[model samples]
Target: MDIKENVKKFIQSELVTDRKFADLQDKDPLISTGIIDSLGIMRLTAFLEKSFAVRIHDEEIIAENFGTVESISALIQKKLP
Candidate 1:
């Protein structure tokens, strides 16, 4: 699977259990929509760090970086190489 797919899968399988969010869109607002909170972001950060072997710095953990699946994927992509 790819970055967006992995993000969507992780969000669905871990953060949320609602059927409505099973097909989370890439542009969906994860933070503003309440799908992901502060704690949720931390969990997501940990997951991303471990899963992708990328180190997310403190300055990078912002709404712009973790706003949606697409944004998160972009952040991960930047950290990858």
Candidate 2:
């Protein structure tokens, strides 16, 4: 699957307790909407690093980078060669 789908899947399966998370749009606001919390972001950062083989720098762990599946996918794309 693509990065966006993978990200959405990760959020759905691991981060949020809400099953409706599976229906969030690609560009939906995960954090702002309370679908994922601060701890969830940390766990998601780890998942991104391991799953995508991308090193998520401290400065990169912001809303612009991890706000949505689209943003996360964009960050991963930028990290990859």
Candidate 3:
């Protein structure tokens, strides 16, 4: 699967337990939707680093980069060669 799909799968399977929002869209607001919190952001950051082999610095972990699956995928893509 692609980056967005992989990220969505991880959030759905690991972070989000509620089945109501099972089908999380690409541009869905992760933090505002309560699907992700401060801790969840850190977890996601680590996941991005390990899964995508990208070095995510602390300063780069902003809402612009982690707000949505599409944004996160974009960040990962930007970091890649």
Candidate 4:
């Protein structure tokens, strides 16, 4: 699957337990909507690092990068090559 889908899947499975989130859209706000928290962001950062082999620095872990699946996908794509 694509990066957005993969990120959404990871959030749905790892950060959330609600089955409703299985269909979370790409633009959905994860942290703003409380679907995930600060700790969740850390988990997602680690996941992105391991899954996409990107090095997410401490300063880069902001809402602009991890707020939504689309943003996260863009961040990962930016890190590649």
The lDDT for every candidate, in the order shown, is 0.89, 0.85, 0.89, 0.84
Tens-place lDDT digits, model 2, residues 10-76: 8888877876666878888887779768778888889999999989999988878878888889999
Local error of candidate 2 at 67, Å?
1.4
Candidate 4 residue spans exceeding 4 A from truth: none
lDDT (C-alpha) at residue 67 in model 1: 88
lDDT of 3 by residue, 1-81 (tens): 999999999999889977887999999998788888887887888898999999999888888888899998999999988
- Tens-digit lDDT string for candidate 4 (1-81): 888888888888898876767689989888767877877777888888999988999999887887788888999999998
TM-score of each: 0.92, 0.90, 0.93, 0.89
Between candidates 3 and 4, name the one with more favorable lDDT.
Answer: 3
Winner by TM-score between candidate 4 and candidate 3: 3
Question: In model 1, where do residues sit more than 4 Å from their true spots?
Answer: none
What's the count of clashing pairs in each model shown?
0, 0, 0, 0
